[model samples]
Target: MDVAARLIGSVRLPGAAALVTGAPHGAPAGRLALRRGDRLEVYGVAELFADAPRPEAAFPAPWPGWDRGVDAVAPDGSFAVFSGQRAVRAVAADGRALWEHRHGCWGPVVGHPHTGDEQEVCGGLEHGSVHVPADGRSVWAHVVDADGPEHWVVLDARDGRETARFPLEDSAASGSHQFSLPGGGTVLLCVGMGQDGVLLYGADGAGTPDGTGPSGVRDLGEDLDRILLDVHPDRPVYLTVEHSCDDLRVHAPDGTVLAGRDAAELGEDRCWDYAAGFADADTVVAVAENGEDDGPGHWLLDAHSLAVLGPVAYPHPVTGSLRALGDGTWLTHDRATDTLSRWRRAGA
Candidate 1:
């Protein structure tokens, strides 16, 4: 049967990359973060979806452009942490300096002279990202050093002190991003190495099985370059697509494959896109494209069984990748008009 989608609500957000939903440990339940170039606009989730879009607060990001760092907004939209080449700094919403942790620069040039603190490097070949867990007490940062391997460091959210650090053992040429799991106790890290491949890692926070601090980092062993898309809103299972966009799979917290579907199961000559994710607990919304000659297609699958339920029938044309909200709704951004839209199953 065909799964139809209804336009729930949409708002025009210029240069909006994506909408950041609040987790219990992150933003407030009803607040939403819209990430633009160098700042974040916080809005009420209900208000933005209700057609009355007004920014409740604005959080300005720190130095270095978006291309050089992977930053994140605090849970209450009070401040933002930027993971730059030479340091990971936290700045208040009012542009106040909270704290900073300095490190080796990620600049690719070997033996790059460290002239002075005043010297600035704009664009670089390598970079990293950061994530604030649900607990919002510490920041998980991926940083590259000029002399050694890349490391993942846990920083004290209040004073910018380093609590824990681990080497990634992988080279990143295009930077990376971190996804804070719903419970705020675990996180998934994805590092892009340009043409080489992608790397994935997982770690546990405070509430460890043995009441330890945070568990050691574990590599997901992605020989096929798996790109994690999303996690179950209430569970540890996550969604990922192969780097080649050939298949989509759901995996357990321990990196075990729960279920999966490939292009052969989707449609003839159609491959899965990397933007697929959990539309809800029981539904997976994915995009499959049939080459550049054909328009990109959207499909729904049984989240548990990984069965292809059918394609999502939108009322009108919707462009861009589907970003599932995991609440029986998803979002898509029209690059042409820079409009962000939210949708749900019709008659749902």
Candidate 2:
């Protein structure tokens, strides 16, 4: 395949970075990723359905009074906003306040939890936040006087109230891989500085592990830097931007490396997976962002064999986040123009 690389378009927005998710067809759908003079400007994808650009959602609160900017957008459509000193605001998607919390891991533990819907979002809350919701209200929140082992609490959507909280068996931080699965399951790419690996938590349900009752927990032992989790019920597992010595490893539930690649140099763990990346459940599109021209660089390699499909170049560097829609194009961040860009690799 001959790879052609170029900037699809240069968006004109300034301020901070953007949290971009592509539309159904790899086109900018749900909402356009925008930067707002420093705060987040409202350019939600829901505007197309409504009038005058009212996002079915918005971060009603301004960026934390004392913070750099919103660090990330959740796989559950929530925003992982920075709130000074390791604090994060897990804003809900329904234009509601899900929860405002801080990191719990001691040193390097990825702890970002995503809001799966417009209803609830999750994260480590300060003041020891915890409350389980019932019948649309927070059942109870055990206020953590201090920031120790705060549980991942389920909350009520209406008023940032808690319902129930459970302590995390482990204290791995939320890395770039914090996301919710199709069924309210939380996935974390645990990079514990000393004892790191990948761990998954799912709502305790009928088919889940018997011991967990309603919650499902599994450990995929391996230190990972960046990973792209595909929670779409249609596509589970994940297509990752592996960050150990510049290697990409695609795995299955059984820990099988479906596809693998090694990079002489390391790339961003949190990279663009536009079109859910070149590697589908069966194919792997392993790419590096620091190429001369377009992103694909001088050669598009077979994720497993490093075989050359062709060379690809980009007008700018890919930034922010990436989404795999499974079509042919990918939702990417072009840092040069700061536009939510796309890359067509399948049939382009």
Candidate 3:
């Protein structure tokens, strides 16, 4: 089966490298954020498809020049949290350091003694990720410690105080990604270990003030290669693509596999790409490229049952993955032209 895609609209955001959405259940559902160079550009879903005017607002990155570690802008775009080599800092738009929580260096060098020089640690091959929940009152980070162990930590957004932490079991992490669940306080972390495999962990905490509460980490499983992608906009479920592109699965907040589809079901020698997302409550847009294809193939899946609905036939050729805006539309990035195009099912 083949489903046609219509070009709803497109915007040219020079240097825009990434896309992000708030918790599936977060408020202001039509808003989306983009990482453009050293800043973040926030725009409303309606604006992107209609006016394509200047962004609603832009927030400067906490670490302006260093792009090694991952960062997340607040839901309201008031502040941004930077997961740096030695510390996680929350900074405002005016470049004010609201707070900083120091931790071990994420660099590979042992006892390297980071001297606060971005260039010194820019060569490191490893890094971690940070995220802000929907409430924007706390920050979740996955970082390495001085004792050579990675830990998932929750920090108070107001003061940068460590509220809770748990050391991870996997140590051969090349890097990781952090995702915030729908309700706001829960989070999921996916760690990549080069060619070995990937690790997934969930951290639950209400962002308590006393640094003590119902906070802990749950290991999704061992010898896992799943990469957590996007969460359901109206549910606590999330999407994941197998590291080797073998399959795509929808998972509950507690890490239970709700539904899955193998790459073999797509075509001969076909594999799911590392990216897939919930276009809306009942639909998922995924990419699966087979050996015979000249480029990646886009497909639509039943969000609940993970059943292959059909391939997504675009009006014109598109490249790379689609980033779901969670408002019944998805976006594709064209690196050759530095353009971000939004699309939807034709006649939808």
Residue-wise lDDT of candidate 1 within 192-265, one digit each (tens)? Answer: 88778888888887743222446866888557688777888778788888888888888886688999898777
* Residues 301-336, model 3: lDDT tens digits: 999999999999888887577778666788888878
Instruction: Tell me how candidate 1 scores on lDDT.
Output: 0.74
How far off is model 1, as Cα RMSD?
3.3
lDDT of 2 by residue, 69-158 (tens): 223333233442323223334454444445665443222224544343322223332222111211222212222213445344443333
Error of 2 at 105 (Å): 11
Task: Name the regions of candidate 3 deviating beyond 4 angstroms.
Answer: 20-29, 48-52, 113-120, 213-216
Candidate 2: stretches off by over 4 Å: 5-8, 15-17, 20-29, 32-57, 66-147, 156-166, 169-177, 182-214, 222-233, 254-256, 264-286, 289-310, 313-327, 331-340
Ranked by TM-score, the better of candidates 1 and 2 is 1
Candidate 3 has an lDDT of: 0.76
Ranking by lDDT: 3, 1, 2
lDDT for position 3 in model 2? 63
TM-score winner: 3
Order of all candidates by TM-score, from best down to worst?
Answer: 3, 1, 2
